[model samples]
Target chain A: AAADDLAFHEFEEAANLLAETPDAATTSQSDKLTSQEHVAVVVGSGIGYGAEGEEEDDKTSLLQDEKPQPRFWTFDYYQSFFDVDTSQVLDRIKGSLLPHPGHNFVRHHLRNRPDLYGPFWICATLAFVLAVTGNLTLVLAQRRDPSIHYSPQFHKVTIAGITIYCYAWLVPLALWGFLRWRQGTRERMGLYTFLETVCVYGYSLFVFIPTVVLWLIPVQWLQWLFGALALALSAAGLVFTLWPVVREDTRLVAAALLSIVVLLHALLALGCKLYFFQPLPLDHVVPAPQAIPPSPNVLLPSSVQPMTTF
Target chain B: AEAEDSPGEQEATSSKPLFAGLSDVSISQDIPIEGEITIPSGTRAQECDSSTLNESIRRTIMRDLKAVGRKFMHVLYPRKSNTLLRDWDLWGPLILCVSLALMLQKSSVEGKRDGGSPEFAEVFVIIWFGAVTITLNSKLLGGNISFFQSLCVLGYCVLPLNIAMLICRLLLLAGQGPINFMIRLFVVLVMFAWSVIASTAFLADCQPPNRKALAVYPVFLFYFVVSWMILTFTP
Candidate 1:
């Protein structure tokens, strides 16, 4: 019933838009400069791209019923586990750089696709890097103390990949959901706009990308410092993209929400540092050298035979 | 092409920034976001074009050899634009299976002339069985893919593992040491990791998320076992 209502509303809106479109088009040529900006914004905010060439017919009865819906995003978008699309993955890497000060790349580029294809895939790949590098750090730590046992997560390839992929997807998703719910909208914003938030959130986490290789530094203090920097950058990138879009009346509410986002990044970076970028012997409770004395009885001469009993 | 050539200055002159008063930020209207630009432009996967399947198998080995080779290399990017997946067929898999069998034949029985070697038999049985088992698992687990499609994807995804095996065989000649052991271990681990990722990219298309993972797990284990074999291979 709601779907039918929505379709009806869409049709009615189209009719009204058609009626207005003629006048809009008549002025549109003169208004092209101003309207171009509006078109980009409309397209950027997830409304479909402005179709050209049929402006006059579209103003009449071109709105027959509905068009071939891309149904681009599944109801869940990237919320589905089975979802995977390489183009979506590539788009996201560009999406992460929404902070770049140039042609409004985010609004321009992201206008292309309506779906969040493989946020999990991007997260998982990064997690895979973190897993391997974390394992490498563990090896370095173990060299410092023979007794240090590595996390069992690295014991199997699939286990580590899935563990990293699943967790990476879950944490960001939870954060995105929290921010959206906090936005005070019950009827979710239009699909494209909603996914832009999701994409921006996923891409901002690319701040953690450096940690994949930086974990090899093997210095505890350096790793901690890098982790903090990554957290700040990731948090800042998100805030920048999200800042303009926050409802004009509720700027304070958005600010409050953003601080929490910063906190989430802190927690994420700390989690990565503790779980993934552990520095050798820095946080663990290692016994002092003096605790175990070199007992003469146990310390036999080089020629003495070793005990064979198990 | 015309739109892409539009002036960057126009975007600068016309568009207001996302935060208008804050800065002079602007976005070009002509920028093509990939999904919108690329996906529709791609050659679509043929839906059960069985009549051409046999002919494609021959062409895959004969005329389409270079294309198949390029697709094998695309395991790295796994881009949606790869025409191999778009024009999905049996030839890619047939070439892969045959070449892989030949590669394993050399590795499994490099020093032995024994015709009835168990390693040869094991490779033969396991490759087909692994492919069939995965197809059945996907079918039973509610995957909406055709049997041949699954077979084709499974075969292509093994390219990395095949490359890893070849690398291992070459590294085995460098004499044993901690460095050699570590390098081999790293390669195997990464290849194992890539196999899981690449396979899931093409093969993970079922519903009821948990079931998809269940179906994928066996493929993961199968690749893991293959990597393990490569890691342990010694002359």
Candidate 2:
């Protein structure tokens, strides 16, 4: 009878514990719901670090949309052209330097937002570099033999700047225009924006920086090797990156355009190396100082004659 | 000693009267002195007299010149980019650019049959143009920097190239020889690298991590061109 009474008490205790658990569970569940609400508020406020900044950027963009778009003639319109960050620029440059086998740099890297910043500067820098380095190689050659009469040619800078600018900008413009003109519904994939073409050309010249620097070494074989390597890399980069854009064109047109690109790049590389890095002609001596009449009497007559004629 | 002490004592007594006169004015005005008369305690005010105008002007000019010199020294041994960014000025750059252009410029009046060399304007334009374009490139690359600050650094970094130009000029005067040529080459190459390194040192912090190479390439090219001009500069 005692054992039965004990068993009954044990069952009552078990039932009491079971009854307390639901109350505890309900309170805990309510606490979780409240905590979740707090988390939602925090997220909503955008007080968090990484994702919040993105949210802020979105907000700014949305605000900008609310404002009227700037006209094309205004500075604000062009301001949008420089909207790339360092990582994006670097990625594009790297893509240009080393062309990936299967990647379309245009589609992958530059589709949404093509930038003018890299192309503009790259062409300018290349123009300056080619002119300066060309002059330097000539100077280096002159130093090896004092007998050779060499004057530092400054015209190269202007020439280089113009050439590079034209190639980087105008060629792209023409290519873009041509492709657009030829593009039809059937050949829609062949068209790339003018900026995209320029961007490719501009970034493609990056490999030449180190190559031109290497050209300073004065080794014939080494210089050629660098020039060839650079040309191949840059041309390959341009050709392959632009291949998909021209893919939908007829085989002949595509082939012709691609070959022209490769040819122009080669011509530029070869021209820079040959013209700028040419050795001093060992056969040519410093031209003897031209005979100017040392006599004041003779100089007076010549000077007076010019004045008289005028 | 007695004479000095007597005068000092007399001055002290006289200064007391000066304060006393101030207090008398306050008393006469009937402004109840709520607090002890606090003699407007400060260094005696200086008069803007004509006698010191020249001296003051000279002092200011000297100070500005000294600051420019300090900036030049800073470029030579660049420890921090902030030294440049803190007080960016175009003075050093202007001087360097002018001197470089003067050195590099081939005057058409010199009447050489070959007129292909760069004119003064060309060199000037290239230097300024290259710097402006490079700065624009950095700005476009989303670098957190200002235009003038970038220009100041780029311009100042031309110091090495200028020095190399000077050396090359001197070496050219020594007459052409293999040894002289080698020295010129070495100097030009070293200074070229120095210029690129120095500018990059100043510019590297402003660039984003991944695109440092992108930003630096232009600077490298800019200096390389200038150094090339320096190296190949024949009389």
Candidate 3:
């Protein structure tokens, strides 16, 4: 399908097609960036997070290029995350265990500005625990079926490598981008703070910690059952943070968004577990209606045929 | 004790970022796009100058990657993309359309095996019809947006559908549950509203004030049909 869309019209040519819109020709404001300038100044200009609130201090590495390069992840580098006003990030940490960190996030940093330092570590920590649990999951699986020799697909080394990047950075970064995009979609423009969303997610992932106990159980169905329940707790945490932000303006919208957020949080957590941790021996992409027959309650259309499970 | 308490008490109006000289927003925002730099022909410099050029190139690539990431963000939120999109490229819309198509295809691969698969052609025809219908309606109602731009906006607006489709598909992994039904209901409903809000927001720049409501009806109906499909077709 994607190949076909590419055949139908290349995206760049489509750009050329619209490269001549009147709006394209003239952007006469200070922020209106020409094609070249867009690349040049986008870094210095804050498009999303507290664009006006922070100052830019260029890190001229060459001033001491000959000087001994400090080991990366040095204290100063870690300190950069807290360079911004952290009363909010601090408040979030204090309120982190609770359901609603958004209030502190909103009051301290506003909805737009969030300190990622604390949230980043919080997520990283959970990701570490998740990595450990993932290795344990294979062990438990093998224990259940002693007669069936199972060569573990995921060694500890590979699992560690993944969690190091995934939980610590990639997941958080993806959430940050998605949140920024969502806030941009909304009228507030800055309503859902970048750090606030990250903070919510960081804490939300905490649900994975207790859910790690799911690894102890060898029963496949039970592990999944526990996984869903565990992820639901994380989802609830996300909603708690999200609720206060949207509730005042639009109750229905807030409720609606909270549901999506919860669902997403749960899905992400579960998906990560299934993909990374639960190395189920039975590997097949069983499309719907193949594995499980439709329940008696499920009334199928006349055209649809139900198939039995494997 | 007094001095320590003083700093804590002075939290009144401190607007500076938490660390002094630490809140430089440019670093993470810089995405590395250029693998390396090519000096202009005949422009040769000493080793030192080249290193600085290398540093500059590195910084530029980072900024470029950030800029590209920002562009993608714009695709997700076209209303915000208004500025980033001036140098319109097919990347954003193509990404969005492909993502939606892939997600729908993934969700309904089962239906395909069983026949009645609304694969690429079916999905494209639906999107094309919806986008055109709204574009025509908008034009009649005095919207100034060009057809291609509407296609671009309308195409990107399906992002919410992609998300909703993912949620629905993921829920199917859990099999039939009464609670699953409710969760799907809530997800599709929000995504429906989100898709509508996004499309309407994108069209706001083009629609006339008096005729805006009329212009939005078809847009709403188009999305309503899409949302209805997402809701009814549970794989």
lDDT of 1 by residue, A81-187 (tens): 22323343455565564455333324544443333333433454465556556656756666656676433222323444565555455655665566566556634
Instruction: Look at candidate 3 and tell me the lDDT of residue A273.
Output: 50
Candidate 1: which stretches are off by over 4 Å? A1-66, A70-92, A98-106, A142-192, A247-251, A279-310, B1-147, B156-176, B182-235
Error of 2 at A54 (Å): 20
Q: Looking at model 2, give its docking quality level.
A: acceptable
Error of 2 at B13 (Å): 22
True contacts kept of each: 0.00, 0.62, 0.00
Best by TM-score: 2
Model 3 chain A worst lDDT window (10 residues):
A55-64
DockQ of 3: 0.01
Model 1, CA-based lDDT? 0.53
Report the C-alpha lDDT of model 1 over B106-207, residue by residue, as the tens digit.
333434542222255556565667788777656644466777777777778877877787787788778965699799999988888887888787767543
Cα lDDT listed for each candidate: 0.53, 0.69, 0.51
Best-fitting candidate, measured by DockQ?
2
Tens-digit per-residue lDDT, B150-203, candidate 3: 766676677787788878888978995658878998999888888788877778
**Please, what are the lDDT tens digits per residue for candidate 2 over residues B80-197?**
6487887899999999999998887554455345665666787898799889988977776557789999999999999999998888887888897768878998999999888888
Candidate 2 per-residue lDDT over residues A178-261, each given as its tens digit: 778778645467567787888888899889988888889866657767778888889888888878877887899889989987
TM-score to true structure, per model: 0.44, 0.64, 0.32
Cα TM-score of candidate 2: 0.64
Query: Higher-lDDT candidate among 1 and 2?
Result: 2
Candidates' chain B TM-scores in the order shown: 0.64, 0.76, 0.64
